[model samples]
Target chain A: EAGVAQSPRYKIIEKRQSVAFWCNPISGHATLYWYQQILGQGPKLLIQFQNNGVVDDSQLPKDRFSAERLKGVDSTLKIQPAKLEDSAVYLCASSLGASISGANVLTFGAGSRLTVL
Target chain B: TQLLEQSPQFLSIQEGENLTVYCNSSSVFSSLQWYRQEPGEGPVLLVTVVTGGEVKKLKRLTFQFGDARKDSSLHITAAQPGDTGLYLCAGDPAGNKLTFGGGTRVLVKP
Candidate 1:
């Protein structure tokens, strides 16, 4: 089976520039998540979508970070006017939404590494 | 507020050695999950512990959940180089959202 797919394995952009990362989740998965992971730290949830409807995005920096999972299959995370601190790996994951035990199993794709100058 | 804290931010040991990583939190969670992430990759789920005081073993790795449901640990026996990765513990506070710990980077030298 094909795992989650993310485009542009790596990207380099100057500060204040705009960049976007795309993710194709696993088939039949109803839940998708976008996470930001800084070097030497764990991934932090930036946004979550449940079948095209956003479930949570409280941690997302609305001023600069935005994400959308249109049609509930693929997702895109965009950072406008990227900041130097925005340089990090952006990870996309998906899961079957069910019970607590069932929902915690997340299948993640190789992340998109971004470097902002 | 970050709900999870992992101890020993980094670990480096030779093959065949044993090591343990701890995840502590004050907030009680319905379930806790452990993930292993390699450099340049996203985190991969290793185990999920729901019941308090539950213990699960996966080959050379063992995961234990605290009775209070606010803590967890990962233990590796006769660790191999293949076990080298960043270990992270995540707690589900609610609504399918996860709070991740700081992560512990493990390096098992061959």
Candidate 2:
């Protein structure tokens, strides 16, 4: 019954630098997601992965942001040449990947807080 | 992108007070979830309301979905210090994609 796990609980870097966050979802979970949470806003989905394939990534900043879930167990979210606006908490979550009509409650990680100077 | 809006961005109440937070959207969703988050942790799911006009209660907390399926509300009675946190509402537009509303930060002072 371990929850989702993420690395680097806090990160500080200068603008134009690249940063990456890692996540390990709960055991047996088949769906993973990456979200960006600003200072006073809710978590915004950046991308979603159903197994090894991506389900949705329309909100991701393609020019600077990229995510991969190799083998569908672990995930990595990267931002190149980060901007000041990119400073936010990066949260990772996982679910059972069941349909909306089914039971698929999400389990979230503590999140990695990024501070771009 | 579907937009979810939450009211009273911030609220502060004394212990034993009752408060309600709302989440609204113009677009319909298949399901909506409510979560509460502390300062340093990710959000924890509080409840999910799918059926329109459905009411679910968890202890002193009550969640209600609008008849139109585009809105939801969370009511807390006899709030305590442990109730202080950020409340977020997220709508599932599709099977796995979620759209979140700007959260409501509640502070219950003892």
Candidate 3:
């Protein structure tokens, strides 16, 4: 039972530069999520994918952030023209299902820490 | 726009001490989950309470869901160095997405 995998562990980019984070969820998981955790703060949901389709992304900043789960097994989150405020850890999580009866437990990744100068 | 508020943003205690953290929200939830995260790793689920007034225990840690289903609490007994970490609470209102609290950072000195 391997945990959710994410990379590259750390990243640094100048303001206005673009950066991308990748994630590979656990085997057989049907729901994937991307969360942003600023230092000293709780992780905030950026986007959620159920299989190959998006289930929720209302909190995502459409102007600068985007994410996709093409085949439903893996996902990528990208930020363009990054701002200093964007500096935070990007965490990836997966679950077996999203239904109330399905346990709804989330297994998270180590996360990718990004520094925007 | 549901929000979960966690109390005592930080806690520092010596080994053998006891402490408790609370998570509250005005919105009702179908279930709530507790997670503990280490410095460089992601959070791992400690427990989930689905029924109101439900109480679950994990070793020295105890979790309880409020009868109104809008609050939860975590209590640790005889804390140890191994218990130091960030404790977070998340609520599943609709079972589609989870709303998380800011988290409680616990430091247990040996």
Candidate 4:
């Protein structure tokens, strides 16, 4: 029972630069999510994918951020022309399914900390 | 959009003390979840309550769901330093998404 796996534990980039983060969810999981957690705040959902399709991404900044789950197993989130405000931890989570029942519990990765200068 | 509000943005107490955190929402939910997150790490699920008025306990931690399924609470008894972390509450107002509340940061000193 391995946990959700994320890569590049830490990243630093200058303003107006670009950065990308990758995630590989647990095997057999059908739902995957990307969240941004700023200091002293709760993690905010950036996008959600159910299999290979997107379920929700209304909160995501379309102008600078984009994410995709190719083949429904691995995901990548990218930010271009990064801003200082984008400095935060990017967390990846996965669940068996998107059900209203208590069975839909999420497991998260260690997260990638991005420091935008 | 549904919103969950958490109380006591931050708390600090001595070890062995008891503390409680609250999560409230105006909209009813089908299920609610509580998670604990440490520095530089992602959140980990602690408990999930689905039924109205349901109560679940995990070791020294107790979680209760409101009778109306609109609120939840987490109580820690005889807290230890290891309990220090940010506590988050999320609600499944819709089957498709889980809305999270601003977390409550707790620090237990030994």
Question: Residue-wise lDDT of candidate 1 within B70-92, one digit each (tens)?
Answer: 89999999999999999999988
Which parts of model 4 are misplaced by more than 4 Å? Answer: A98-103
All candidates: TM-score: 0.96, 0.96, 0.97, 0.96
Q: Residue A30's C-alpha lDDT in candidate 4?
A: 91
What lDDT does candidate 1 reach at residue A28? Answer: 93
Q: Which wins on DockQ, candidate 1 or candidate 3? A: 1
For candidate 2, lDDT tens digit of each residue in B7-94?
A: 8899999999999999999988777899999999999989888899999999999999999999999999999999999999988765
Going through the candidates in order, the fraction of native interface contacts each one reproduces equals: 0.73, 0.68, 0.66, 0.66
lDDT of 3 by residue, A1-117 (tens): 999999999999999999999999999999999999999989999999999999999999999999999888999999998999999999999988755644588899999999998
Off-target runs (Cα >4 Å) in candidate 1 are A99-103
Candidate 1 docking band:
medium
Model 3: colliding residue pairs: none
Model 2 spans > 4 angstroms off = A99-104
lDDT of 4 at B28: 93
Clashing pairs in 4: none
Residue-level lDDT tens digits of model 1 in A11-113? 9999999999999999999999999999988889999999999999999999999999888899999999899999999999998875646446788999999
